[model samples]
Target: MTKQQLFDDIEADEDWLTGLSTDIWENPEVALQEHDAAEALGDALREEGFSVEFGVAGIDTAFVARYGDEGPVVGTMGEFDALPGMSQAATAEPEPIEEGGPGHGCGHNLFGVGSLAGAIAVKRAIERGDVEGSVVYLGTPAEEVGAGKVYMIQDGAFDGLDAVVSWHPGWTNAPNKGSCLAVDTFSVRFEGESAHAAAAPEAGRSALDGVQLLGNGIEFMREHVADPVRIHYVVTDGGQAANVVPAEASMEVMVRAPDRAAVEAVSDRVRDAAEGAALMSGTEVDVTKTSGMYGVLPNHTLGDTILANMEAADFPLSEEQEAFAADLKETLGSPSYADVPADRRDEAAEAAMFTEPLDAPDEGTTGSYSTDSGDVSWTVPLGRFRAATWPAGTPAHSWQAVAAGKDLGTAGMLFAGKVVAGSLYDLLTENELLEEATAEFEERKGDREYESPLPADADPYELTDR
Candidate 1:
């Protein structure tokens, strides 16, 4: 079948795909608890005659579904976790389906389902003898916490894949060739002797003082770090009562940089500041390394192939979809055509790619945030694409994102699913393409080996302890 024919077949199943997206969005499972959502997708793949492996990587919500057994094993990734407190129903206005519950603020619900649709469609093509080689769909969870893909890679989940292609639901449709920052998340705890504030104010060493000092020291270090380094923290624990000299206090810190070495250097400075804080306040300090991820290694071969497929694919938005997007744009307090670059603003006004990559802010415009997908790109020839799902300038992890995720988000998901399916079909049928991507992967990897950013013996479940 022609590529357009294949895309049309998948698009014909839009209703079923939409139902799946809405169901997963309504459930709103968090991180490793994505069992129900994973199983639902697993069942769909199994019915389509794909070989399904449940719990492949020691992660309950992680699995791999595959079809065909020949050369050039192409893998497509799917994520299904939701944000902490964005539970909104499928409405134009923000209305929580479950008050203060989990929601798809990041649009991962559609991410997983749409990817499943793509993999299943490719499986059908292979079954009909239209394509050669195997296609595998990886069910990855907890991307919001920035460690799901890291743990999956560590478990040797993607050991034999020739190439992997994935896409994210966003406010535009473009192939991303930029890198994301590597990050480490850790916590520092201070301990001291507690005493009655009124009776013996001078006798007790306050742990809260140590915490404050640590924050102050970090503020000073901020001015000295590299230009692109970003360090942020939240006070996870403090004194329980005002009258009691706090015996314990804790802070969670996220250290990020353009590359692994830079992140490590900044992290060491943070550790030293914590130590200095303890010394000055006469308190004991304990540092715990929680989890970390590497920066993405962009592959030109894979990127160009996906970009070609994206340019050739059909991504027409409906009028209702455009109206919803405009409504979301107004709600975000951004110009109806605001954040779109000057060149793309006119196209956006004409309802084109909302924030095209050609108009992307910089080579590393997304540096302000980080993701575990960076870990995946280091191991194989991986490519990421963005499809406009929200208004032009709506920031992620907001009520506006949640509202748009129900409609426009699903449209982008469907568009992205077609892109992945088409690209994988090409790889499966064309051995030369797979060979080129693998060669590019080797050239980029050089002498470095894939390493899990997570510390030895660090459990993924530790995220829940906080």
Candidate 2:
């Protein structure tokens, strides 16, 4: 009935949560292909009397599970996608469980299971009549490659949600008041005449030339763009034989900025450069928008709530857990994270729990990466946090991250679950929280409407293989 009881409910399901995390971690699947992960978690929720809906947003791996029939609907987002080539055993060494294989480098194996534990705890509370609202478990897939949540929003999957809470694994724990960049991924393909290199070479219009020119144009454009704008590309199709005048070539281009308008502005220029390259090379070029996500609209109201629960929750690490974290810390290295203070780094490596203070969301702050949750945040007032699943200095999408997550991340996952469950309890019981979140959501959204950066007909799932 009380918040402590809600925490108890989460602790009661520790075995189930552990099993879920272990299962998903052992069988790593990359974005949009988390079939086994989705099924295992879905069945677990269904067995607990939650109404489950699969393929809600036309994404085969995406699903929704809900408990309770009335009152405010508090949704928690979960992702199960893993990264490629980050396989590692849960040891201090940089050894892979399967050399050159996929692994939970981003710690989504813990992420998905942690969020599920929170949602299920809320379901238990609802059954006890301690809460008067519904709990939603969003089974989001393909966050690494496919923007699964963005596609879900396009299909109205997030409609009628009161608030959405999220969590991720990181080197430090904090209420995530930080922001992520808005990003758009697209493709450009060039087609032209082909001929023998040695014979009639003058008659061939090289598509490879167009692709090279386009790359050159983008590289030249970097100096003219805003400081925060990031543009990168990869040649997916750069022709076959060197002796032949290549007839076809393609490139995958990605543009990211702090806001939607900036992303749009840079993307338009990239498109223009592609057209110019085609014109100069005497080749035809086709451009396609693949996927995108918006900047996260962090709600201070929801953040304060989650922060309180994060600090209030008991996250004691055992002696063995501390040793495990220390061991993993030895394998971690990050040039980007070089600025972390030496004392903080030394303490965080062995410290059991709690380091960062709960602070107000900083204005104009942005992280270098992008998440589809940013798309979901634009749709609703969202709160996201991080648990110290890995030791200090661990960088995401690496063997070190994948290594610590194998078993050392279990306690952190449970800690996140308790915090989330506790926060959901307050959201259900406190009307002022939702009212404030809604008011802030409207004031911040202003005239800006939610728009998909992808083309109208683009299939989000098609990019899963990448």
For model 2, residues 1-466, the per-residue Cα lDDT tens digits are 5688877877778887888899899999988779999999999999999998999677788999989878799989889999888887777787787878889999999999999989988898899887799999999998888578888888888988999888998766667776879998887999999999888899999999999999999999999999999999999998899889999999999999998999999999999999999999999999888778898887778888888998788774667877877766655453244323454555554543333633533434788889899989889889888787877667788777787676778888888898889888888899998899889888888989888766656686668523
**RMSD, every candidate, angstroms:** 2.3, 2.1
lDDT of 1: 0.80
State in Å the error of residue 319, model 2: 2.0
Show the colliding residue pairs in model 2: 31-142, 32-142
Across 280-368, the per-residue lDDT of candidate 1 in tens digits comes to: 99999998877798887776666777767777777757888877777666666544543445676677655523734332333345455
- Residue 30 displacement in candidate 2 (angstroms): 0.9
Error of 1 at 103 (Å): 1.2
- Candidate 1 — worst ten consecutive residues by lDDT sum? 355-364
Off by over 4 Å in 1: 335-341, 349-366
lDDT of each: 0.80, 0.83
Model 1 misses residue 140 by how many Å? 0.9
